[model samples]
Target: MALIPKETELQEGLTTIFEDLLLKKEGVKKELIRTRKDFNIACDQHIKSGFQSEQDWVNANASHQNKFIEYEMYCHIIDIITDFKDIHGQFPEYMEMHRTLSQIMIKLAQDEKYELAAIAKLWVDRIESTIQEHSYC
Candidate 1:
């Protein structure tokens, strides 16, 4: 039988991945081009290995790239959140802030100004798909 991921497992996995990426934010930004290219290749390999079909792999790769960008953006936002918490000694109402940030992400994706948008979009799609598919089983 195929192993199906639970919703909690998916959420935990995504959170862990993003947090790890956040930890690498400075390294990634300092070496943007090289790091981004390396990240893309790694994502490609991961998707290729996971999906049985070539088209599915392509789709997943695209989605993973988008999510990578989105996570990068989120990392920056996290810095701001950290500052806010430092000042107030409490977390902000993050949901509203996240909504606004998501709008910015969509705009970035629409404008096609950065490859990060594609990566972020791809990331979200794959995670969502994985969660849904696993939950159904």
Candidate 2:
């Protein structure tokens, strides 16, 4: 027979996961900031060059945008994972967690918490997109 994990065990496990994800998020955030700074410097250089090197600015802008997306995705994943751990005190199957989040989004909307509801909707959309993308693989 399989033994159930204790609450403390679950909490400890979640905490470990949270810490790891937080580290990754911080790394992404740093990269995002660095890319933004590079983009800004490129912009200044492009201006100084009388708009001669458009490619440099364009590449910097693309890098910054990619890093920003990565940072945002990490933030969303961390928030949703923390929420799941706080509510259920255990790791949830992805689909179950997604469904629960969807219900939460609806409840938040019904309660007139529009900002939070919108955030939840965004999380749900992210998760749905991830699932769809992985299903093809």
Candidate 3:
């Protein structure tokens, strides 16, 4: 569907020349239409990703180069906390995070990212405590 701009303050600034280019040049008009199509495609894909919130998008893109320890840690932590709040308890997700962090902790500790390693270790400890306190029946 062609988008017809309604009369508004921005329409008042259309300034004639811009409209002429769009009206007279088929290529310019086609490109403008393509932009809208591209935008809709992007929105559809973003919706399909099961994106929960802005934080989920941020964490998904936070990895740098080939290193992913920090972003992985952040995602796992958020998952645990969000699940805890939503369910009034927890699940095995934290145990999986503990395993992943344990594998990376050594490398992180040896590098400048030791602080993050420490945080992951602390997260593991928290998961352990949660499991112990809230034993499964």
Best by TM-score: 2
Which residue pairs clash within candidate 2?
Answer: none
Full candidate order by TM-score, most accurate first: 2, 1, 3
Off by over 4 Å in 3: 1-90
Lowest summed lDDT window (length 10), candidate 3: 9-18
Tens digit of lDDT per residue, candidate 3, span 11-97? 222223223323434443454455545555555656787654445444334422113444445555454444433242323254554
Off by over 4 Å in 1: 1-5, 32-74, 77-104
Kindly list the per-residue Cα lDDT of model 2 for residues 1-137, writing each as its tens digit: 97654544434544565576678789888999999999999999999999998999999999998778667756876777766664645555656767877887798799996755775676677666655544424
Relative to the true structure, how large is the alpha-carbon lDDT of every model?
A: 0.54, 0.72, 0.47
Better of 1 and 2 by lDDT: 2
For residue 114, what is the lDDT in candidate 3? 74
TM-score of predicted structure 1? 0.38
Question: What lDDT score goes with residue 82 in model 1?
Answer: 51
Candidate 1 per-residue C-alpha lDDT over 97-117 given as tens digits, one digit per residue, 9 for 90 to 100? 344445655878788756655
Compute the lDDT for candidate 3: 0.47
Worst 10 residues of 2 by lDDT: 5-14
